[model samples]
Target: MRALSVYRDTTGSKLVLDDVPEPDLADGDLLVEALALGVCGTDREIVARGPIWGTERPDRLILGHESLGRVLEAPNGAEISPGDLVVGIVRRPDPVPCGYCAVGQFDLCENGQYTERGILGRDGFGSERFRLEQDYAVRVDPALGLAGVLLEPASVVAKAWEQLDHVVRRTRRRALVLGAGPIGLLAALLGVQRGLEVHVVDQVEHGAKPRQTRDLGAVYHSFMEDLSGTFDAVVECSGVLVGEAIARTAPGGAACLVGIGAPHGAGTVNLGELNLDLVTQNKLVMGTINSNRSHFEAAHQALRQIDRRWLEGLLTDRLPLSAWRSAFDTSPERIKAVIEFDA
Candidate 1:
């Protein structure tokens, strides 16, 4: 099996595609062949900061989590079968399960001891082949084709919108999505599907990001300064704009922070004033990360409702496994980039 891996030591290399042994599967486990793998900001961060959460393995660590695969082997009575398209959920419950983990909400593990595949303690699905327990694998619509790799990231936004649905009680709302990356754009797409007027903010003015935002029947803005009026809901997918996004929320709005990035160095927020605004305005600002199986199921259905051509347009770059080095480079026009294994 050929897999892309990063070394355990601290050298800033992108990734190394190595020929490794195929993993042995358990009797009840399902074998899946990699079809497509989505590479995101977190993958780049792991390469830049080696030996982080993903270095739990002894030697090199597998380097993909957002993946799409086809089942090759399934235990008897497994919900999925051979040739079915699937995506493996990322997180696993801790040894001593938390309250949330006990109920299959490992995404909300109270003790923060959960293991995330490809990102934390477990080996990821970055190779030509991998094994997953059937329970953790969710079937994706076969019609999605190569675009199915996006289900993991889309699941995150789907969970965010589900949370926002519970928080806000108003109708005909307006939503502001910060950062026009995969997560942000998907968040906007979901908001539009929910009948809200969606507005997307990103630094890129004239590229595919802005164009796709408009394609979804949403407004696009390159800068926050030009944004008019307030939004009933705000989703902060650009971690750098958390403070700014929250400040722009309406009096009764809800803000969901979905992106994971460190704060820009050397600045302090006015905690006192910010607290006052949140309390006095009846606002809700929350952070959401991983998703559960149900969220993945929801994302699968949601992705199907979207225009297939538009969904395909989000996939701007596709590289073969041999061109692994170039896959990690960030580009202005790229909404989503993937490495195609079964192409």
Candidate 2:
């Protein structure tokens, strides 16, 4: 099996396409043949900073977490079967089985011992094949085809919106998503599905993002100056807008931070006034990371409801595994890039 491995010594280096042994699957485990894999900002960051969370031996770990595959082998009694399309959940519970992990909410693992496939201690799915426990594999709609690779990222947005639904009380809500990347666009898609008046703000003013936003019947803004009203719920997918998004969150509204930004330098904050708003406006600000199994299922449902043509449009590139280098290359017009294994 050929897999994409990143070198630890050379941070910000390209992935090395090498021949690796095929995954060994247990009887109850699923043997998934990779079909398509989505590459996101986290993938780019790991390639740039070296493997900070996954393996200490940087180059040894595989480098993909968002994936779509077909089951090659499934135990007779298992719910999954051969030929089923699926996406593997990245994180596994820690050994300590913290309260959240004990309840199958490993996404909130407390001990910080969780192993995230491709990103943390475990090897990723940047290969021709990988094996996972049946419980960790979420089935994808066959109709999605290559589009199913978006499911993992979609799960994160689904989980974030699921959490927000609990805190927000407004019937007719308005949402502003801070970035027009995959996460932000998906968040906006979910918002539209929920009947919210959605607005997306990103640096790119006249590209696929703005067109996609309009196609979804949502407004898109490149600068905050063009942004009109405060939103009842703000989902910050780009870390750059945290301050402004937090500032513009409507009174009694909730803001969710989903982007993981780099540390540049320190800046002063008006904690006194921010605290005053927190005290009087009943504002809520929360940060969400990964998603759990249920969220994956929710993501599956969300994908099913969306127009396949729109989901297909988000996949801007589909390079084969041999052309892996081009998969990681950053492009201004690229929306989503995928490494296709078989198709």
Candidate 3:
């Protein structure tokens, strides 16, 4: 089995694709056969901006974290098994958090669980047979196909809902998802799934972007108007500053920041007026770093029912792993991109 990794030398240079050896599974780990893997905004950043390579011990690394696939083996009586379709999370939680494993918040284990078993950096799932923790492998119905396979990516959005209660410790359910990118859309859609009237906002033209939000019952907004402190909670996955800066967070409302985009140089929280007001107000503002096993499981469970036609539309283009250079170099409006493996 072979895999594609993004490499940056010790001197810090642009990323290059490398075909490397497939990873071997450790105890409590499972081997998965890759099917359809989506290129994430994070992956784009690692390639174009190089934030991820900088996180790893070395800059050189594999570059995919969003993926759906089938399981090939499961040790003992683990919940996963061969032939079971699955959606996998890229980040792992640190086990040393006071009680992450005890409380099931392993994803947030403070010591280091979430970023420890990264799928693409040193243990990524971009290869034909990638090994990952069994706990991270949530089962998906095989019937879902490529679209249903998105359970993991969709789960990335599900993690925000877990925090909704945490954000609004005591408040109503009105919610806002800023940015409308895949995660933003998923966040907005998940809010709607839980009966919250969600407002999806972004400055970008709808363009050829997949309109899945409509199906999930979220009303799209262009952010051309003032929000006027309307939402009880806001999850920021748009990766832009203004969304955080201009967000109309109600008093006591909780805000979740989930995007990767940042201002150049000493990136400040360019929250416009909201930044100054948030301090005096009793609002709960937090930065959620990554998703955990429960998030991965919950996300996969909900995504199993997703409409493939709609999900596939999320894909803006399909590039072979070998064509990665052209995929990013061309830099077209790639809404969703997948690197299909050759049989």
Top of the candidates by TM-score: 1
Candidate lDDT scores, in order, read 0.86, 0.86, 0.64
Which lDDT tens digits does candidate 1 get at residues 228-316?
98899999998888888778899988999898777562135798988999999999999999999989999998999988888888888
Please report the candidate that would top lDDT against the real structure.
1
Please identify which of the two predictions, 2 or 3, would achieve the higher TM-score against the true structure: 2
Per-candidate TM-scores read 0.96, 0.95, 0.81
Model 1 clashing residue pairs (backbone): none
Give me the overall lDDT of model 1. 0.86
Point out where model 1 deviates above 4 Å: 10-14, 26-28, 51-56, 265-267
Model 3 RMSD, rounded to 1 decimal: 3.7
Please report the TM-score between candidate 2 and the true structure. Answer: 0.95
* Superposed Cα RMSD, model 2: 1.9
Ten contiguous residues with the weakest lDDT in model 2 = 260-269
True-structure lDDT of candidate 3 = 0.64
lDDT of 2 by residue, 208-271 (tens): 8898889999999888899887889999987777778777789889999998776731234588
